[model samples]
Target: MQAVHTAATAPAPRFALRSSELPIGVVAEQLGLTLRAIRHYEEMGLIACGRGPKNVRTLGQSARARLAAIADLKALGLPISEIADLLGPDGACPDRLKARLRAQLEALDARRSAIAGYLSGL
Candidate 1:
């Protein structure tokens, strides 16, 4: 006799999310970031999020780490465009970044030297 299958006997579909992966809402709350900002980052290609069950956005470990780095860069006053270029598709800082960093460092040193000179003269 053929075996009978019923709804009760059918296996429930499951979303195969790894333990390290989190939905966007959970990630935003955990990271102390607003959902809008997280979504903006997603749209900017700064962090890649995978589609979870029911099309929910899920961020894996690397994407979460990237978001943390993005937050740090934002805190350091780096613009989104520059951050995007710095963390581009290759996921490595390009050679031009070294030049940009040097330029920024030189400007900062110049400002610091000027401030010190003013303080010394006063």
Candidate 2:
């Protein structure tokens, strides 16, 4: 007796991301960053951009991530050199990265506790 084979099912369709080709103003607004700050990051090589025929800057996904990272690191009071080192490709890690982040969190918590203690005593 011969056995029958079953047909395979088709995969589901993927939803495409809808992002506009944004200018600097639009990007600044979307990222909640100032135009001057974005320019400074670009100048520091933290963010990359493509230049149009008229030298208009166009940012890509990597640039967006770098910009966000820079903003976060700045808010955490990290120096630019340290942020650049942290964002470097060779510096990306599976173990060391987590350790570094934990250290930063601890430091932030300690600072917060100190501030709270001072406020409580005031």
Candidate 3:
């Protein structure tokens, strides 16, 4: 069955995949992600790919969204385990996600302060 593209399901203009059930390589190319990285995410249970004709791995719309979300979380310095939890079946509670982001911000602030202190001494 073909997935419908709603505003939410539609890929971002910045990084769009052409179709549902695209080959893993196509998805990687479209998203500017490496094949190994996609495979790793699959191995980590973060995304699941289906086997298309001739047993080729294919990523559907949902998997693409998960991959994008995973990249966003990774960019924000979230550990994979934490990301997994956030993206789990519960579908990312806003309060929990906010708390995690707040923690990350606090950690960054602390690091920045320490760096400034060291610079002052130098």
User: Which run of 10 residues does model 3 get worst, by summed lDDT?
Assistant: 12-21
Candidate 3 lDDT, 1-122, residue by residue in tens: 99899998888665444466788888898878899999999998889988766667789888888888888888888888888777765334467777888988999999999999999999
lDDT of candidate 2 over 8-61, digit per residue (tens):
554533532235345676678887888988888788777777654356676766
lDDT of 1 by residue, 1-122 (tens): 98787998976568767788899999898878888998899898788888888888999988998888777667766787898887646455577766777887899899999999999999
In model 1, where is the ten-residue run with the lowest total lDDT? 88-97
The Cα local distance difference test for each model comes to 0.82, 0.70, 0.82
How many clashes in candidate 2? Answer: 0
TM-score result, candidate 2: 0.63
Clashing pairs in 2: none
Model 1 segments more than 4 A misplaced: 1-13, 29-32, 53-55
Off by over 4 Å in 3: 1-18, 90-93
Error of 3 at 72 (Å): 1.6
Please provide TM-scores, in order, for all candidate models, with all chains considered together: 0.71, 0.63, 0.69
